[model samples]
Target chain A: MAQLFYAADLFGVAVFAITGALMAGRKSMDLFGVLVIAIITALGGGTLRDVILGNHPVSWIRDDTYILVASIAAVGTVVWVRLTQPIHEKGLLIADAFGLAVFTVYGTEVALQHELQLSTAVIMGVITGVAGGVMRDIICNEIPLIFKKEIYATACIAGALVFIALRALATPPWLDTGVAMLTVLATRLAAIRWHFSLPRFHLLDRD
Target chain B: MAQLFYAADLFGVAVFAITGALMAGRKSMDLFGVLVIAIITALGGGTLRDVILGNHPVSWIRDDTYILVASIAAVGTVVWVRLTQPIHEKGLLIADAFGLAVFTVYGTEVALQHELQLSTAVIMGVITGVAGGVMRDIICNEIPLIFKKEIYATACIAGALVFIALRALATPPWLDTGVAMLTVLATRLAAIRWHFSLPRFHLLDRD
Candidate 1:
């Protein structure tokens, strides 16, 4: 089970790193800038979550493997994009969905282990699932997708709710995890396919 | 001494919050958007520092006062601007310098309390002083001022180094704190007055 979790985490890291590198490429950033953005997108969310939970040394700082994987993924992304023009939009979206699903479940599990309240744990899951992308977009001088009427954070919230509900029913842990991941993946992918989005709030206009 | 620290912290929060609200105003964001940006700008840096240092419950989360002050400041900014056209740039800069000075000293004190290495403590101080503004700029879809050949972060670093030196000399804690604050405030103000800036990195251009 631990090995499975580790593998999934690495996969998520690589996917997120690639996305970050692609963003940097679009911005015409240098190699160092690309690498920095990739690392931040791969680890920023988890680092924030751990720090908020008072888990010291942070995961990547404690274990070098995460950084190593992200670096390789970033370099590979730069090379691939340089050789092949642009990445397919659909493919990138699918990969991002996978990362979001895996990270949401992992973040929820970690928060639960720390005995946080259910509401807080769910929020933590959403934060972990979206913060990296948010940070990447912000650094690229763009408004964060999650904050810009996207259904992204909503998908994570739905997944976290499913996880909490399954745990309450005493479902097997593996089954609960699987269900949560599927929920997030499906919701996110469906949203992308259908061009679904949350309604924008306009307080000043209303007044 | 505790009262003085509390006053300084509150002043910093108000100054930062106003800056965030002003940025939001420039972007033509609504009231809610302005408030959200203001809160993030006021508390984001300290939150990041605390989380990185494995300090749980985060200071703002532990105490409701920070949130209260930030919200009030945000609302006040919106009202002030609505009633009076534009915020005075000079006034804003001075307030920001006050915030930077106070936060740099306060962050250093907190890191030192945790017995961090001198270099680490100094870095923490700089992070605390600048991260909020960095976040504000990012969320507003602008390049961070600190990263754009500005003398901003350098001022914080200078103050932190001064703080560390004073501590090594076994100076009175109050004196040390005062000197550090003065150093940051003076440097920042002087830089602004003289239009001083750091050299920009142009690696790609040079190549």
Candidate 2:
């Protein structure tokens, strides 16, 4: 189980790094900027979770492998985009969804192991799933995609809730993880397909 | 010394919160959004600094007073803005400079106490001073003002180095703190007054 999670975590990091690098590319940022954004996107979410939970020696700082992987992924992205057609926007979104799913489940498990309240765990899960992208968008000078009338964070929230509910029912670990990931992925893809979004916050518009 | 630092920290939080709320007002964000941005701006810097250094129970988490001060300041800004003329942009910038000075010194103090390397301490100080504003700008969907060839972070870096230098030279605590804070405030205000900026990074402009 640990080995599976480790592999999935690295995969999530690579996908997130790719998204960040692509964003930097869109902005025509230089190589150093691209690498900075990529590492921040891949590591920001998990780092925030660990810090909030008071977990010492944040994962990447304690183990350099995560940093190495993110850097390689970022550079590879620049090379690929230069050599071939840019990644399709649709494909990018799908890849981001997978990263989100993996991150949310992994974050939830970490929070649960820390014996935090279920609600906090769910919040942490959503943060882990979406914060990197939020930071990426912010650094890229755009409103975060999650804050825009999107179903992105909502999908993570749904998955987190489902994961907690399943754990309550004493479901097997593999089944619980699988179901939770699918819940997030399906919701995200469905939202993408249908172009549905939550009601926008139009508070105080009567200026 | 500890008491003085505590008072200054709370004051810094309140000032930063006001700046955040004012920014949200300009964007016409809702009240909840205003509060969220305000709290984040006030606390984000220290939170990031502590997390990066592996400090536990982050300052605001360990003490509710920080949150309370930030909330009150945010709400007060809204009321003040609604009842009176909007704060002058110059006034706002000056206020932000003070906040920046206070946060930079306080963060460096914390890092020094942790016995980290001097370079790390300087980096942490700069992060603490500017990160909140960076976040505020990002959430408002704007390129961060500091990243735009401004001397913002540069001032923080200068102040951090001064603080470290003074401490090494066996300066008195009061003198060290005052000089460091003044270095940042003076440099920032001078930049604002003289309208000078660092050279712009035009890396990779070739299409």
Interface RMSD of each: 6.7, 6.0
Best TM-score among the predictions, by candidate number:
1
The complex in candidate 2 yields a DockQ of 0.12
Tell me, by DockQ, which candidate is best. 1
**Candidate lDDT values, in order:** 0.82, 0.84
List runs of model 1 lying over 4 Å from the truth: A1-44, A51-87, A117-123, A134-207, B1-40, B47-95, B112-123, B138-141, B147-207
Instruction: Give the residue spans of candidate 2 off by over 4 A.
Output: A1-47, A56-133, A139-141, A145-207, B148-150, B197-207
lDDT of 2: 0.84
DockQ value of candidate 1: 0.14
Q: Which stretch of 10 consecutive residues in model 2 chain B shows the poorest summed lDDT?
A: B27-36
lDDT of 1 by residue, A65-90 (tens): 99999999999998887788877767
Residue-level lDDT of model 2, residues A1-207, one tens digit each, is 888888889999999999999888889999999999999999999988887778878999899999999999999999988899877878777878888999998899887887776756776787788889888987787677665444777788789999999988989888889999999999888878887665333223222
Among residues 3 or more apart in sequence or in different chains, the pairs in candidate 2 whose N, CA or C atoms overlap within 3 Å are: none
Count of backbone clashes for each model? 0, 0
Superposed by TM-score, candidate 1 places the C-alpha of residue B106 at a distance from the truth, in angstroms, of: 0.5
